[model samples]
Target chain A: MKITAPISTPAEVEPLVRAGARELYCGVVPPDWIQRFNTSGVNRRVFGNLNGYADLERVVEKAHALDADVFLVLNAQQYGEQHLDALTEIGARFRSIGGNAAIVADISLIASLAANVPDLAIHVSSVATCRNVESARFFAGLGASRIILPRDVTVAEISAITTELPELEIEAFVLNDGCVFEEGTCHTVHLPMNKGGPICIDNYQFEYQSAGGGQPHERALRRLEQNDLDYKRWLWYRFGNGFSVAPNGYPWGPCGTCAMPAMHAAGVHSVKIAGREGASERKIKSVELVAQVLRRIEAGESEEKVREFAVGLRGAPGHCASGYMCYYPEVRSRAVVGEVEAKVEVPA
Target chain B: MTIPQSTPTLPAPPGPIELGFALVDERELAAFARHDRLTRDDYLDQLGDARDCVSLPENAEPTHFFLGSEFCEHLLPSVESIDRAVALCERWGLTFGLVTPIACDGLFEPLRAALARLPAGSEVTINDWGVARLVQREFPDLRPVAGRLLGKMLKDPRLPSATWARMYPNGLRAGPFREILDGLGIGRLELDFPPFGAADMYAGIDFPVGVRAPYGYIAKGRICKLGSLSLDTPEKFSPGHKCRRECLGFSEVGARPGTHELHTSQRGNTMYYRHAAGMATAVAEAVANGWVSRIVLSGA
Candidate 1:
């Protein structure tokens, strides 16, 4: 499997590529588009985008020199007519600059680019919500060469898609940045941090009003309180414990390193490191983490050993044990069972 | 009231407007029956009791019924329930429609089984492209309508309608999307009444448009907060986990004090906001002018 890392500047290209990223992706928000549409540009990010075509060209050139492919992100769920025209122009310019692919979500844009700019390989973004094999096939028919599976999809679903469509390249998320909502179907805007930030992460005080006519019993009320607590805890984990970093410098967030062996066996061609708008150091560390795990898998290490090594690198055994940081929690079930078996085999 | 002499009147479109009801279960039928009698504010602010019954106005009675869900596959009704809904619709002489959610691989078979239960020529609201492709390839007889979930718009409740309308005036209208919809045999496009007016956005579209009233969805996710309520901490917020359908009992309403007046309600995995009282005027005007073909009333 290959590691596809996010890079914004030409400088980030070399460090990310040297850190073991085989493919690089970034968003370019030109001044014109930003002026016309504000920071809610063609991509989901509000920051860390290359400001001009010249910068993007340099990014592509540098990555290509390092024997790595570069993809420009135009992956908004839907774009207006003006936005579409500008994006199509951007796609043509990227192709002219020798960019390898365009990661996109809108079907119209996908079909348009496939027909107009046939040379540019299209990678369907996870925001397209390709959870099923049929969705994968649909995008493939529309000329997408790669499908980035959404983060919420199970390992079994990923296996099913890879198994059904062996010809299409499949990418799965490995580390950092998990959304509480399905990114594709969510219509709420993520305004700038100055403008109260993403709606999903907004701290709103909740009041549970019963739909039933009569008042609920005390036990039922206690259950509802517990439900509220559980919901808040889940949100906290989903937001990466308010984006805290570990003492070992690894980011604490939704991770899928334990599922790497399963994903590799399932024919996932690449693993994606999310957070393109994040700092370059974090991006490099994420790529390094995935690269290390992939190297062990390549060396034919057992899945259990790889899981242990991945947990060790992440540096939070408690979070791993709780399965709160897992993108695929199913792996934890297997790991727990394995531990139980090993304990049983040991002499008392 | 003094009439504004400067207001330009547009000619009403020829043909009758169709009214429809979108219900999650039989329990919602009671609320929907009194839909026409309740004002927009009354419906938005005071409809807490699900069992409350009120009378419907004769002229405003619905002629169609849309069953099932557009967000959660787990919330999909059984095949028997679908058949019963269709039978009830038949008895009431109302047209029956099916709303399918953005489904995963596991839901494909069950959705197909449900689709098979529908009679020929029934309208099926498709929220996912995969579901659209599946219906087009398999159930050729059923007509597909692009659902509101598929219609991507700027739907922040905190923002004014004018801002959202200006930002996303034309949704799913650019590129070859209309042609693609045609290729899929979609006859109509379904949209929610945005806080902003719908007339400008609904204009110049090729197919007929259907608008859902009052509750406009802001966001949705696969990991349902209500479903997570019953699970332990380790399994909390896990996507596709089994649930007790806690959302059917109550919804969590939220407000950000000292920020915005927009209140959000979390029903199941989806977050929705009630549109302003005057927001429907533009949609009503659009309906009068032939831009909007139908108005669907949903009780959350």
Candidate 2:
């Protein structure tokens, strides 16, 4: 399995590459506004990307010299005129640098890169929601060299995909945070007239409504509902989508998680870490952690030990729930009932 | 407008309509391009192929490019820069809009300032309550759509059920839709419709594709529930400061990719629509079937 790590500053680039990360993905630039619809929820100020493309070019060059590939996330949905020209300029820079590839979702951006910078490879972003074999094929057919699978799929589902699309390279997340809502279901947001209704806050509004109006809704509903909240809980339990529940509620520190092995065992071509949002220290440490785990896996450690080491890196008490994968009731039942150490010491 | 003597549940519309996909800024476009690493050809192809535009017949669709916004805080950026960019689109005959004030602070201050400078009947989507409200209140001739879904959900979770039954003051709930209905603007709702392709892909994933899900290297699903959330939190229960855990963006059943079986081929699936085509189809169906006469398409 290929191990990928996130790097943000110039300082951590070396450690991540030394840590056995196959490719290094970083972002020095803010997400361009063209594709705001897809990622309007994330606060841009948090990542310090306000500097724009010049900063990104600097970061990419430094990362490349370390012999690591940089996948710049220019991934935002495009909507206006200035956005197109910005892309053209950015595309030219990407082509000049010989960077690994550009990851994106909007077809127009993809189309733009194809026209402006043919040398750069296009990788379909997970944000594009390529869960089915067809979506993967569509992107691959459109020249996407790699497709990232959604976080909630089980190994079984991934295996099913491999069976149909054998040659396609699959990238999965090993250690990083992921969302549980269905990516790309935003028609309701599209409605021009505000349908005088209510908005659910804690990710389970659909369940609240279908469960007989809240308490009764949870008790009376015989079958599951598809609201954002229910689907969130379902994914958490079924696919192990809940990786590192920060003891303090914030997703920070090494105790959070490192997921490369699970992704490797599941047969993903590349095991990537969620980047850009991470701090330089956390990013460096994350790379080291994954490298250590990869060495152990390559040394032929048992799958149990590998998983244990990965979870142990969390430095907190927790177990893998496979929430993002398929939710087989029996598997979930076994996992819920299984004994897990929750805290294992990372190898010195 | 008078209501019909009898109100019946309306059937979903049929057929897909063309979208004049537009957005708010250059940074957004650059970000999207970097995220996807789309090629110039890919950009042009979408513009050339985009036949169905969500535009007034005279208003052309932005050429197959991902449309972006010209909005800025407290200031209307010079149209010369925008004109230069739009000139590219006009050369290609692509229809894109220079949207302002969709999701911004001090909404109308910038919009009125910007609108005053644009041509009459220029195509633009506005989301500011003040602008929408003022458009209706002052400039009834100008059509501006409400950008946010304000009153549709409860702002305060602590409010009693009884309080919800009795509608709040018209302006109080106006945070989401007041700009549209108050005739301050176009009195139209602009849906930030999440694209369809990824939803189908997301629906095929087994886990919850929400922000609260665990972090890992694999990208399995999209965050569909963020901006389109419905008020479905438990009674007076607070999940604390974890924005990831709390803060449901909207109240709706977000798509579940976990249960849906993903077909390798786009042709064979009946249970789901073509990932990209579905959005267009939904809009066309809505219009052709008269579920709605028009809709403003804002990507996010």
Candidate 3:
């Protein structure tokens, strides 16, 4: 499987590629985009954006010299109609830099990049939430070359999509950036979190209130002062359903390298190591580790041996510890979804 | 009795727009009735406190109805429930919309076929792109509305309090995003009414948008509360294990640990948030200025 790693500046491309990155992805926020659209820009990440076209151009050149592909990210989940003009300019600059693809989440942007920049391959970001075969097909129909599956899907689901849509490249998570909730559909507002507030980590201290019968004093509904606030909220926290708080703090960036064998069998094209905002050393270590596992697995190592070795790389993603950080969490824990009942015929 | 040839259409009167409600199943509908069953004035006063109340006005003649789960197929309604929803909506002359969760390999065909059999022009809110494609390819007659789940707007109620300001889409040019959705035949955008950010700003966006009200939907999980509550072990409360569907019995609610405000509630697999003081006005302003075209109220 191709290992796609994040690069920060032009300097990161060579080392990452030599460190065993087959594909490189990066983003840029020009002066205009900053002045006009003051948010995080099209990159979704507040940090890790390339300073300008020159930096991006340098990264593409270095990566191309190593015969590696570079992808520019426009994967922000939301986009404004006013920014389309800027989006076009960004798309043009990315293509001019010899970037191989555009990783995108917004449907309009995917359509935009595909049509306006015809040659650039379209890779749907995990935020697009292609959790099902039909969703993958939807993106494929829109001319997407590859789709990065969400962090929450099962290996079996990945297997199904790869087998069903062989023409399209399917990528899944291998190392880092695990979300407590499914990424594509989550709306927890990460960037400007309150003091310890990004709900994913369960940091925000919450007050429980009764939602039934329109309780006049929701807060006064006898909180009972339970020691385990998490447990109490599980039973009584009724709204649409339940909250997804990252366990053990923000280390939700759990690795999934152990699933390499399954991903290979499933025909997943790439294994992603997240953290565009993370350190280059960390990125390189992740690439080297996953590459070691992939090389061994490819070189006729037993699946058992590889899984054991994968764990040796990091204690995370080992066996199903039922930890909140693990992606494809079912790989270790009894998945918290799929509640469909067994259909059995009862003899009358 | 004169049987009407066509179902009565629910157009917004010259006053406020007609509001609708979303329920996961009959149990939620019943839950809603228990609250609405109280004195109208009393219920209105306590609307924000109701377990399933989505900030809907009591005078709301819910002309449109979304009846199903939008995050997990495990939470998806049974066939019997679908039929019941159709009947209830038809009886009340409400536009029936089936809420679909994430697209699963096994559930797509069956869900598509089931939805196709509904009344022509029925609305189907889609969270997965594959399902969006399914509606375009197989059920063109059904209106495919991209609900808030699919919008993925990052909004947190605690944000404006702790930080300077969160970024929101202010406007857009006639860029590729609009043309692409247009090509796919998707004309509407459903948005979450975030706590502090834009509900949103799809300015120059040439499509009608809808908002999930008072309790704007925040995050969704593969973990489910229905089955979770049954187990004494929180870790054991996971997906795919045996479930009595316990979410039907009770829901969990809480406020931020140190503060009584920024409250969150869990119903099934989705989390809903009640906005802090005065933030509702900002969300309302977004809706008023056409950032959001309608308010979508649903049970988790």
Candidate 4:
């Protein structure tokens, strides 16, 4: 499977490509858009965009020269009519600069781009929430050449879609970044990180009460406590445990390295490393990790060995054992359930 | 006395605004039929009588019944349940509609089965684009309504009204977006009353709009942390795992206290907050202007 890495600058393009990214994706926010809409750009991210079309042109040129493709991100959930003309203009310019495709989320935007700029390939963003084969077929009908499966979709579901629609390219999230809620269905605004981050990760004091008023029974209280603990742990995992990197320099967050064999066998065309706004080093390390796993899968290594190597490289067997960091948790249930060695080993 | 004349009142719309009831399952449908109104016992308990339990206006009888969920595919009604809902709607002379969640591949067969049971003109409120495609291809006769989940807007309850107004001054008035919906055969778009107000949010939209009231969803996921409470750590956050439906019994209330004074409730895998006091007045104005064609009362 090809590795699709996130890039924020022309400088990032060469490093990510050298680190084994066959395809690169980035977002550009023009000064006018930021001045008008403020934080609400064409993408979910509020910051970390290329300076302007000049930067975009530079990034595209650099990627193309290095034998890699660049895709522009216009993947916000929805856009008003005021944004239509500017967005169309951006797409036309990106295509004119030899950009490979545009990653879009809004169906209206997709339809508009497909009709207005026919030559530019469209890859449906995961924010579109294309979970089922019918949804895939729906987007494909609208001129989408690729679909990025949401992080919540299971490996089995991913395989089902890829197997059914062999003609359409299917991409799955394989490394870095996770969301507490389904990114596509979540409607809360993500203010800048400094101004009180995403609402999903905000700390809140929770209290459990009976539906009919008054205190809950003892048994129910116990369960509620467990639920509370589980919820917090899940949140922490989703937030990448304070966004810390592993001792081996691998990024810590939701991962799907072990599922690569199954995803590849299922005909998934590419694997995406999320976190377009991440630091350059983090992005490089993330791409390097995925490239290493892809190399193993390409060499026809055993699934068990590839998983073991991936986990060891992550240097967190305990987190892996909990299955909290897995993008496809079923891989653990199927392959690592009875294997104690995989759970106990921690790379020094 | 003549100097204090009140503002002139505009003429009322031609007819009573269409009222609809959105239920999660067969039990809620039966309760609504028995009580003749929708009530959130949990929501009331949380507020401790500060607010009323009934979500609807006084003595308002609903003309439509919508069954199913907009966020969780696991909560999709069974074939038997759909049949009973349809029968109930027919018996009550109410329009029948089906609300579908963001479905996975495994849900397609069941979703199709449910869609097949609906009558020719039943409204199918879809949160998933895939379901829209399904209706367009196989069930062309069934009308598709763009459910509130698909209506992406900034809905941070913690933010003040002024912030929301500034953030989204004119909500969802995009021509191209509406045209796409029109092309997809969607007749009406479902919305939540924005934190600021509904007047500006509902402006300039040509299609009919349905506003779901009292509780607006903030965030939702497929993993269902509430449902997985009983499982061990290894299996806790797995998506699409079977569960005992713990969310049906009660909900968890959260408060930010001294921070932003944000209060939220967790029902199933989704978090929601009650709409502001101005929503009712805003809905009245929207309905009067003929922009909002329906008001669907939900217990979530």
User: TM-scores of the first chain across all predictions?
Assistant: 0.92, 0.70, 0.81, 0.94
Which digits, one per residue and each the tens of the lDDT, describe model 4 over residues B1-300? 112212122345445666787778556555445543333332133233323322333323467778898978778888888998888777777789999998887888898899999999999999888888888889999999989888887667766446543543332677767776777899898988766665646856887788886677888888787788778766787786887777777777877656644347888889887665555566656767677767777766
lDDT of 1 by residue, A1-348 (tens): 899999878889998999899999999878687587754557766577887888998998888898999999988777776677777888998999999999998888898899889999999999888888888888998999999998898899899999999999999998989898999878766665665578887766767766653444678778878876666655666676567777776777888999999999999999999988888888888888889999999999998888889888965566677666789987774453233212111011
- Best-to-worst order by DockQ is 4, 1, 3, 2
For A280-346, candidate 3 gives per-residue lDDT tens digits of: 7667776777788889878988767776675545433312332333455455423221233212221
Error of 3 at B263 (Å): 3.6
Tens-digit per-residue lDDT, B124-202, candidate 3 = 8877767777788888888888766766555555564523334644223345555656666777777666655543455
The residue pairs that clash in candidate 1, if any, are B161-B196
Instruction: Give the winner by DockQ.
Output: 4
Model 4 share of native interface contacts = 0.72
- Write one digit per residue (lDDT tens) for candidate 2, span A52-124: 5565666577667777687766554222222545654666676686667877755445656666777788877
TM-score winner: 4
Worst ten-residue run, lDDT, model 4 chain B? B1-10
So what's the TM-score on candidate 1? 0.91
lDDT of model 4, residue B47: 34
Go through the candidates in order and give each one's DockQ. Answer: 0.52, 0.05, 0.35, 0.54
> Compared with the true structure, what per-residue lDDT tens digits does model 4 show for residues A279-348?
9999999999999998999999988888888877876677777677789888974355344423432221
Candidate 1 docking: what grade? medium
